[model samples]
Target: MGRRLIVGTTIDRVDDKSLTENSAAANRTSLWGGRFAGGPSEALARLSVSVQFDWRLAPYDIAGSRAHARVLAGAGLLDPEELGRILAALDDLEAACASGTFRPTVDDEDVHTALERGLLERLGSLGGKLRAGRSRNDQVATDLRLYLRDHARGVAARLVELAEALVEQAGRHVDTAAPGMTHLQHAQPVTFGHWLLAHVQPLLRDLERLRDWDHRTAVSPLGAGALAGSGLPLDPGAVSKELGFRTSFANSMDAVADRDFVAEFLFVTAMIGVHLSRLGEEVVLWTSQEFGWVELDDAFATGSSIMPQKKNADIAELARGKSGRLVGGLVAVLTMLKGLPMTYDRDMQEDKEPAFDAVDTLELLLPALAGMISTMTVRVDRLVAAAPVGFSLATEVADWLVRKGVPFRDAHEITGKLVALCAARDCALDEVSDADLATVSEHLDPSVRDVLSVRSALAARITPGSTGPGPVADQLATAADQLTTWRNWTAESVVPR
Candidate 1:
C-alpha cells in the first residue's frame, strides 16, 4: 500500500484537466509510453505547470498529427488503413476537445502525452504506432510556431486598426495649432495632427516587424525529432505542405531548440508596449486639470474614492503599468535562453508564459487605446490658447526680421532683446506698443509685430510637412492614403475565412 501510494502521488495529472475527467484514467501510472523505469516523483508532478499550460496547444498538436499522418502514408511508412485511422482519430480528438467531451489523465505530463493517450483510447493499439518516428521535441516546437504565426497576423491587423484611428483623428485636427515640446518644455508651434502622426509612424514600423516575423514563423519544425533528424525516410517537406508551413526547418537540433522567433516577437511587442506607454502618459497629462488640452471620456476614466471631482485616466495608467510587465516578459525569456545547450531544455518551457503574456497584453491594450482615442475630446481652443503662452511665436518674429533684411543671427538677437523688453513691460510681443518694441531695438517695426500673431506665424511656415494649415492638410491627405493602403493589405494577407 505504501509503495502504491508513493508511485500514485508521484505521477499525478494536471488538476485543470482532472476536475472534468473521471478518477480512473486520471490515476494512470504513466503519461508517456511508460518509457522511463519508474513514475515521476509525486511532488515533482504536483509542482509542474507543463500539463496545465501546455494543454492550450492541443488543437495545434492534433492538426500537426493529422498532417504528419498524411505525409507518413505518402512516404509508405503507414498503410492506407492505418493512416485513415490516425487521421480519423485526430479529427475526432479535435472535436472532442473542442466540445469538452475529452478528458486528460493525471499521468499525462504534457499535451503531447494527453493527445497520444486519447488517440490510443479511440483507435486501440494502432494509435501507439503513430509515434514511431516522432518525438515531443519537434512536435511542441511546430505547434508553438503555428500558434505564433496566427497571433502575429492578428496583432498586425489590430495595429492597422489603431493606426487608422489615429490618422482619422489627426485629419480632423490638422488645422488645430498646439505647442510642440523639447525636454518637455514648450519649444515651438505644431499642428496637433503632426503630434498624432509621430505616434502613427512608430506603430507602422512595429506592424512591419510583425509582418516580417510572421513569415519567419511560417515554417514547420516537425520531423526533426529528439535533437536529431529522424532515422526513418520521413519527408519533412510533405509534412510542411500539409500543415500549411511554408518550409521545413533546416537543422534538427536548431529546429527543435530555436526560440529566436519568440524572442523577436517579444521584442516587437515590447517596443509596441513602450509606444502605448508613451501614449498613455501623454493622455494622462493632457487630461489633467493642469494641462486641460484634452478631456477623456467618463467611460475611459475613473473617479477617485476620496475626491468627488477626480476623473483619473485609469485605462491609460493600467496600460502604462502593463508595459513594465511586457518588458519583464522579454527579460524572462532572455534569462531562460542565456546559457542553454544546443537542443531543447526544460528551460524552454518558460518560453510560452512570456509569449502568451505579451500577446494577451497587447490584445487587451490596442483596443483600449483605440477606444480612448476615439472617444476622448481634444479641446482645440485650449490647445491653441496654450500654443503661444511661453513666447512660442518668438521664432516667427525673428524670421520676419530676417525677411526685412536683418541678418538671421542679428534677427535672432533682436528677437531676444524684444522678448526681454516685452517681459519688462509684463506683456506679450503682440501686446507691446510699437514704441515699446523700438525701445529694445530700432529693428522692431509695427510691420514686424503685425506678423507675430500665432495664425500669421503658422501660415508663414508653408514648407512640406510643416504645421501650417496648408501643409498640415496635405500631410493628413498623404496619411489617409497610407492608411487606406495599410487597411487593404491587412485585409488581403490575413488568414482565409
Candidate 2:
C-alpha cells in the first residue's frame, strides 16, 4: 500500500472546517469576533501565523505532549488501556514525522492540531483526551522557552571559542611591546598580550551572562492554560522534569505572558555585540596605513574595486555593522513589551524573530572573528618602532627623578623642561646625552639616561598588572589555565545530533 501511494504520492484526508474558524477548539473567543459568525474570512486566514510559523515548534510541542501524556497517566485521568493507546500513537506520530513520512497539511493550522490529527489518525479516536488540560497559549510559550534554552548554550559555547582564541593570541604575544592609547593618542607602552587579554575579560563577563540566561529560560510553562491554571489535576513539576526544565512557572498568567527571557537574551547579545564592535573598531584602526600596528590576512580583508592598493578591513566592518542589528533586536523586544498586558497577546509573536536573528548573527560573527584573529599577523617591529616616537618613556624619566630625592612636583617640572628641550632640538629623550641632561637638572645624572630607554622603562614596571614581562607572563599563564578549563567543560557538553 505504501509503495502504491509512493508512485503518485497522494493520500486522502478529511475536510477541515477548523482552519476557517477564527480560533481553535481551545479558544472560543474569536480574534475577529464582531466581523464574522461562522468562520474566518479567507483574507484573514492567509495572514495568520498559526499555519505557517507555529509549525516550526512541532518538535518542542511533541516533546511537551509526551510529557503531558505521562502526567495524565499518573493523575488517574486515563485508564491503562487508553494511556497505552495514546502513548503508542504519540510515539508513532513522532517517529513518522521524524522520518519524513508524515506531511502536515495547511488545513491542520499549527503543530498543535497537526499533532492531534496525527494521533487520532493513528489510534482511531483514542487520542482526543490528550490535549484536554492545555491551550496553545502556554504550549507555544513553553516550546519557545525550551528552544531558547537549547540554543543559548550553543551561543555560549561559540562565545567560549572566541574567548579561547583571544587567550591563545594573548599567550603567544606575551612579551611583544606595543603602544597603548588613551583618547586615540599614545599613552604608554604595554604588551600586545595585555591588550588581547583585556578584550577577553569583558567577553568572559558576556559568557557569564549567557550561561545565566540559559538557567533563567530553563523553566516550563506547560500546565498554564490560557491565562489561568488548567482545571485538570496535572503534575507540572513532573512534566517539567521530563522535558528538562528546571522549574514550573509560578504563575499561570505570567507563564503565558512573560517574554522577559527573550528580552534578557537579546540584551546579553547586544552587550556582547557592543564588545565585538569595540574589538572591530580597534582591528580596523590597527590595520590602517596610518597605524599599521597589525596586518590582517588577505582572506579576512578586502580590496576596493577602484583602488588597487586598498586592503580594507571588511570583516571587522561587517562585525561592526551587525552590532547595530543586535542592538536593534534588543530594542525591538523592549518595544514589543512596552504596552503588553498581563496575559498572552498577539504582540508576543514579535519575540522569536529578534531572538533568532541575534543568535544567528552572533554564531556567524564569533567563529569568523576567531578565524580572523587566528590568521592575522601582528606587526611587532612596527609597534615597537612607533612606541618611542611619541616620547612614551617620559614617565619613567620623571619617576627616576622622584627616586633621586626630587619631590614629584619638582620631578615633573624637571621632566617637562627636559622634554621641552628635546622637542626644541627635534631629538628623542634617550638621544639627549648626559651632558645635555645635566643642563636640565643636576638630578639628571648619567643614570637618568638609562631610565629614558624603552626597554628600561618597560622593565621598571615590575608591579602587578604592569606592562613589564613578569606580570604579563603571569597573566598569560592565568588566562591559559582559565581557557583550558572552559574548553574541557565545553567539549564534555557536546549535545549529540
Considering only N, C-alpha and C atoms within 3 Å, which residue pairs clash in candidate 2?
Answer: none
For model 1, how does the per-residue alpha-carbon lDDT over 331-390 read when each residue is reduced to its tens digit? 999888999999988889899878877877887788888888888899999999988878
Candidate 1's TM-score = 0.90
The best candidate in terms of lDDT: 1
The digit string of per-residue lDDT tens for model 2 on 235-334 reads 8999888777778989999999999998999999999999999999999998989889888888888898999999888878888999999999999999
Best by TM-score: 1
List candidate 1 stretches off by more than 4 Å: 1-22, 25-35, 103-105, 404-407, 488-497
Candidate 1 accuracy as lDDT:
0.79
Cα lDDT listed for each candidate: 0.79, 0.76
lDDT of 2: 0.76
Give the Cα-based TM-score of candidate 2 against the true structure. 0.85
Question: Ten consecutive residues with minimal summed lDDT in candidate 1?
Answer: 1-10
Q: Each prediction's Cα RMSD?
A: 6.7, 6.6
